[model samples]
Target: MTQRSITVLPGDGIGPSIVAAAIKILDAAGCQFQYDYADAGLSALEKYGELLPQTTLDLIAKNKVALKGPLTTPIGGGFTSINVTLRKHFNLYANLRPVVSFAGTQSRFENIDIITIRENTEGMYSGAGQTRALDNSSAEAMSIITHEGAERISEFAYQLAVKEGRKKVTIVHKANILKSTSGLFLEVAREVALRYPQIETNEMIVDAVCMNLVMYPERFDIIVTTNLFGDIISDLCAGLIGGLGMAPGANIGKEVAIFEAVHGSAPDIAGQNIANPCSVILAAIQLLEHLNMQDQAELIRAAIKKTLAQGKTITQDLSGSASTTEFTDAIIANL
Candidate 1:
């Protein structure tokens, strides 16, 4: 992990603003990296007439690591989700989203630290859906759940828990209805759970998990589920600690991994200087950890915590009056 080379995609809207802030913070902390710039979202569409260009993917493949900002996916389906396409292209079958209660943040609960590990390459998001009936009638989507996919994600969840000192692993599934797909995922998950007997394990129906997630979000430690379920639950969990404004996600493959903020690109507030930069800064922390730069990662995390706890300079979304630059400066000053 010496002077890692990483692909950087400063996407559309507030993406560039926050990404620049994070890069400055990282540089100040002496994190060395050769950044290969690329494009993938609406910016790519406007610049290259394509949403996801080959050159962008090539850069990421060459570097095998990326720090991506939020991208705007057009409505009415101009392109498949750039995020999904990148995951499928790289076989990034594990989506890791850690939702923890941050100090001085707007949260309904406390002592909330949870990681949502989603099987990224399979389940309903496998992109295996088809539309039949020429009369505009029927459509079908396939949910693939193989033994390998389920076992790998489950094991990844357990291993992460062990490394991160988590105590419980919750397997959320929809096996009550999706007997084949969800059932296979759960069955394989159980097998994987057996390997880590020291870690407590539990199974909950997807619907039930959602209800409990609201009532007692602090009870969950590590939540591992299939693609669609994981996608939904990850956001739900994010809501407990405030919102996506404080959330960061990682898409991990065997050889490559990408870290990004789970929040959306706010088109209305693109260049307003009011957009929050905490999420992107937090995502950069994850990228630092990916490169085994744990000291640098911890430094940024501590700075964020200190800045938030001080409550001196904060963003609008966090119930403060500070602009994005002011908030970012506060974080750097804390460091």
Candidate 2:
């Protein structure tokens, strides 16, 4: 088979190390692919005077697939988040995050399986607008909503539920408060849900959804929500299965898909060899599945599960003493 190429953005801080570990595991799984490196995050700013360089965008355009690591965004002000920028630029409107319980992990939940499908490029993150009073006393940020955006995301969620054989899709929203904005979303989502009659659909206010998530998580199989709600709830779901250290994310569009670890760049731990690479490794598995490489994807998945269950060699976050490299090596050995 021909070797494929994928854009690799190591991102910032411990991003590089974890990304390398993910690549090594992929290699050990007998999956061959050429990695085309690109720069982003603060590191890219230092090199190219920008967080996202044209070259990096071009690389993704050329390869049509990318595997990214945790990228830190400026806290107060500076450049926009590269992750957000890339998603909007690529029109990647669906964000897929699956949170599942694994043995030997720190999560309290057991046998939990949920897929959070977030609207990737709209709502509060729609780049709508921001305005301040002339005296700087008051300010406002915009949350834009469109029928097209809501319809597509809802369709994607229902279709995904059918494809995965999921039983239900819970639509979380704040329609009672942000009536116009979230109302439009819920309205369109219900319309889309009508098409998938076999898949049960439920709706709830965002605040109430949060409460039930912790108390009755087993009631949910799939969650489809707007950008902001999805962002917050995805992390909450992550906490149910495990921390962000074990979560992986994917931004998908009609043209391309980019997979990433949902955690942040641990600048404090950069180069310390103590970061957990499982998140990125799982993202790599998603990448393989995207490419229709099911056999290789299953191999990597089994290897990761076996490695984690053994629990002898794991990163500190998992209550083990192994360094990042050692943890990766254990996964490779399982492979």
Candidate 3:
């Protein structure tokens, strides 16, 4: 088999350790690939005087796939988000976040499986236009939504639903109040939903979706929404199973795709060896699936599920005392 090269960003705080654990697990699962390492985030800022260096960008462009750890964007600086920068640069317009229940985790629900398809490159979250009053009293930011952006993202969501054999897709929007932007999204999504008659389609307001997600999460199989709502709803779905530590996200475009742990870098626990590595490990599974290596992805996922079910070597966040390395070793042993 030919080897594929993947760009690996070890990010900041606990990112390095967790990403290393993921790499170890991928190797154990018998994935054959060459990894090209690069730096980004605070580490890159310190080393190269920039949050995202040109070398890192070039490597990502060359490799076409990246497994990134959580990056910390310095607050109150003239700095932009590294993740946003990468996504915009690559035109990664679709964000896929799936969460499922794992036994032995401190979760309130069971058998929960939901995929949140987010419009990654547009809407209010895009940071498009911003203006502040000279007297520091009023501020405004534009929420831009294009017909092309809405249509493509809607198509992507329905296509994914069909591919995954998902039963229903709930289109979440705030069309009642924000009738211009969100209304456009709802209009486009409805038009796209007509193309897929086999799959069921439901429309819900953004706020109502939140209430129903907490009340009747099982009613939702797939959720497609604008960028800002998707971001918040995905995190809420994460809470349904466990936490952000159990969530993995994929930013995908036509050419390049990047998988990452959806959680933030825990700077307080940087080298403590107690941070959970499941986020990055799950992200590696996404990476494998993206590469069309389904067998390896399933093998690793089964190992993780078995280990988590056994509940012997889970990390602190999972209400266990085992260190990150111990938990990772347990998963590898299961593999």
> Candidate 3's residue-wise lDDT over 1-335, tens digit each?
77899999999999999999999999999897799999999999899999999999999999999999899999855677788788889999999999999998879899899999999988986764343434767667678899999999989999998899899999999999999999999999999999999989999999999999999999999899999999999999999988888999999999999999888899888889998899899999999999899999999999999999999899888889999999999999999
Residue 165 lDDT (model 1): 87
Query: lDDT of each structure?
Result: 0.88, 0.90, 0.92
What TM-score does structure 3 among the candidates reach? 0.97
Q: Candidate 1, after superposition: displacement of residue 60 in Å?
A: 0.7
For model 2 the local lDDT of residue 204 reads: 90
Off-target runs (Cα >4 Å) in candidate 2 are 128-134
Number of residue pairs clashing in candidate 2, backbone atoms closer than 3 angstroms, sequence gap of 3 or more or interchain: 0
Higher-lDDT candidate of 1 and 3: 3
**Model 1 lDDT at residue 201:** 99
Model 3: number of backbone collisions: 0
lDDT of 2 at 156: 93
Candidate 1 scores a C-alpha RMSD against the true structure in Å of 1.7
Report the lDDT tens digits of candidate 2 across residue range 1-335.
Answer: 77899999998989999999999988888888999999998888899888899999999999999999888888756456778889999999999999888787867888889899999999988753343344657656678889999999999999999888999999989999999999999999999999999999999999998999899999989999999899998899889976877889999999989999878898888889999899999999999999999999999888888888998998888788899999999988888
Higher-ranked by lDDT: 2 or 3:
3
**lDDT at residue 177 of model 3 (Cα atoms):** 99
**How do the predictions measure up, each by TM-score?**
0.96, 0.97, 0.97
lDDT accuracy of residue 43 in candidate 1: 90
